[model samples]
Target: MTSTADSYFVCATPRTGSSLLLGLLESTGVAGRPQAYFREPGEPMWAGRWGLPSTAGYDEYVRAALAAGRTDNGVFGAKLMWGTLDLVVDRLGAVHPGLAGHDVELLERAFGRTRFVYLWRDDVLAQAVSWLRAEQTRLWEADGEAEPGGHAPGYDAAGIEELVERIGEHNAAWERWFASCGVQPHRVRYEDLDADQTGVTRGILAFLGLDLPEGRKIAPSHRRQSDELNAAWIERYSRESARS
Candidate 1:
């Protein structure tokens, strides 16, 4: 079944401040609940939260996700990492008969004329360090979510360098995907959001053709995860990379 809801996606890479963007968007209460709706480890958790049975089919999961995710204003949004885009498309096709066997064509079929927002980080080194630390600690966010327990392992230069290359590759893939699909996404940089959260979010609302009440402002719900540790790792990794 084709959905009539206005939909958009935040096409992102890891450690690109997507969590912060999603929080700011949700704060508007009109931008829809943008999140990693198809991410693993969280998908099953969302299924349980949405009250779906273990044996529920993909269609049922899609319906539940949309029902829970769409805002009252009829806008639905989701954050998609390039890594999981295929899985999302496959599941979407399973539910929407008209969307089968097409790459991005399925997106329009499932969510009528979807818009895309590309969020990326300019500082790849910092992003790589942040991703590595988060993976080690399993603390992807800092919004009072339960601490995953265990100290973050000491940084390894090789690991950070590998992640730097991987992040670059993934980001390049996103670029290629957009180019091949012939879609121009509204671009947002992590640095811009970090500098002015409210202004950036308002700009996004305007891009989406949505209006907010006069004088309305919502602070981001989550804190930036990067800290001195990230800075230190970046310095260490840069030195190692330069030496090698």
Candidate 2:
């Protein structure tokens, strides 16, 4: 049976302000909790937290996901990266019937008239720097979850350069996928979201056909991870990139 819940997906890349957007969306209390449900590295951790066996089959996993991921307003949201899109779709189809074919067909079958949100960063250099720093520090989120006393590694020029190329490739892949699917997603830029989170959040809610609750306050649960170090790295990388 097809679920009657409203469904949406955030097509994003790393260091693209997706976490911040997700935090803002969840704060609404009406918008569903959007997250990386099938991210390979995070799947085991999530399964444990959800009280499922690490080796649980696709059907079991998806059932738990539907149970835990849906919000009170019957909205189901998820964030997807281009790299894992095929794998996630394949697994979802294996467990959930009618989602077993092409990308657009699967999405339509599984979610039934789903909405798409495309989130991206225009500053590739800054995006690469943030991405590299997070990899070095293993501090993906600024929510006080990072292990204390780990020395923040110095920036490596080569690493940042490599990441820049990779991030660009991933962003291009997202664009190609959208074009192939013939979908026009609601776009949200990282800079715009960072500049005015509340306004952007409201815009997203309106796009999703959700009304903000009266007298409710929305705030981000996580802080920006960029700092002085990010600025320095970006500057250095820009100079190096310019020379090469």
Candidate 3:
């Protein structure tokens, strides 16, 4: 049987393997076309790309998204970073006044029978390292290659430590929000996803009550970015942290 939810949101923090999961889900062809729709910075870009009027309001944008982010079967999906949730909720309130102050209700009103998938990293240190590198190099993915002469980001112990703490705080905030809404999100761990990506994805599809067609393939869009430099940094951080 399929999950009652016709829509789902992937709630995640940076470097939590959410991107990989989204890609895996999209490959199934039955799952919704998940996208980070509500990130404020990406709103205008998406709006213009979707051919919406420059003066379009939140409701119109959301309508466009509902059409764009769904499969033929009508399961809609979106992504939400913890930091972006508050602003998104406020704007959603403008479009749905009666549902304001009730985040889950607001979402259900906007998108029918919504569910949440919480993706988080098990190793904060490793996650922070990845996030730091992405932020510094501005190379979040292999497709977005840098200029030929782009320099590698050097190690910054303090920066990494700060990011680790921030990621924890964001994770905790997500927990609190879930608690406040009496929500028990489907939990996924980055380390587990990395170890057995296909299996993990199958489990999630089961959770969503989605059945991969017989003989359907689970394909990853991109390879993991971890490399020798990541390993070296991990070792250096371990040694330095132990001394301190």
Candidate 4:
């Protein structure tokens, strides 16, 4: 059996119920979400906090915690959404192209001690459309009212397509990087989690080496559709379903 000293890394794409997973972990006191990066308790932003490291970087942060010598419990875990794979990989490549090669040596050297949790959504096309609508909603809400430029500003047909491609490329690169690292990550399907809570939660617990509290329910929100008659705007944007 892997010792309790083993740590964990939850690596996943955005919109994969990572927040709910993290929330469940938090309740156990065995794992914690990074306060500085995760920001407020429940607000979910894809990369705003999760991708931004402290001055020392992500691996350094985990290393520091380990160095603190506080292991009364078992492993410590943190999440990094896979949507950030491209952004981080590209940046690493610019500094040292070799780092992007087999094993992502730079990253592994920093975080290989962690057991990885890889989360993916099956309906990737729908995920992209959902992201577009969310972004548009944010812009509209930020304006404190409706602007004259339709549902979303500057996000036309071409823009949506680009976003979809970007997300797809990021997902591909994420799988590739982990494979090259020789890391057999624990894979979690978003649809499965939604459909079978008992099974998905058990899988996650088994991977993390943790037990669940009795009567705890695992409910993850993957669908963003609103059912009210007054939610026409949200419906229109989400149901557009025009891939890019």
Per TM-score, the best of the predicted structures is: 3
Best by lDDT: 3
Measured with C-alpha atoms, the lDDT of residue 110 in candidate 1 is 67
Error of 1 at 95 (Å): 3.5
User: Cα lDDT for residue 228, model 3?
Assistant: 82
The segments of candidate 3 whose C-alpha lies over 4 angstroms from its true place after superposition are 145-151
Q: 49-138 in candidate 3: lDDT tens per residue?
A: 899998889888888999999988888888999988898778889898988898888888888898889999888889899888887787
lDDT by candidate, in order shown: 0.83, 0.83, 0.86, 0.53
TM for every model, in the order presented, reads 0.91, 0.90, 0.95, 0.60
User: Could you give candidate 4's per-residue lDDT for residues 1-244 as a string of tens digits?
Assistant: 2333255666766556565565555554444332223222222332333343435454443355443322345455566665444444454455556666533454444444457777788776555555565465542122234434445333354455666687788778778877776778888887886677557766766776665556656443233342242244334545675433
lDDT (Cα, tens digit) per residue for candidate 2, span 3-58: 33378889999999999998899888877888898788778877888999867897
* Candidate 1 C-alpha lDDT tens digits along 185-244: 899999999998888898788778877756667768888777888888888878887888
Report the lDDT of model 4 for residue 178.
76
Model 1 clashing-pair count: 0
* Better by TM-score, candidate 2 or 1: 1
Ranking by lDDT: 3, 2, 1, 4
**TM-score winner between candidates 3 and 4:** 3
Return the clash pairs for model 3, or none.
none
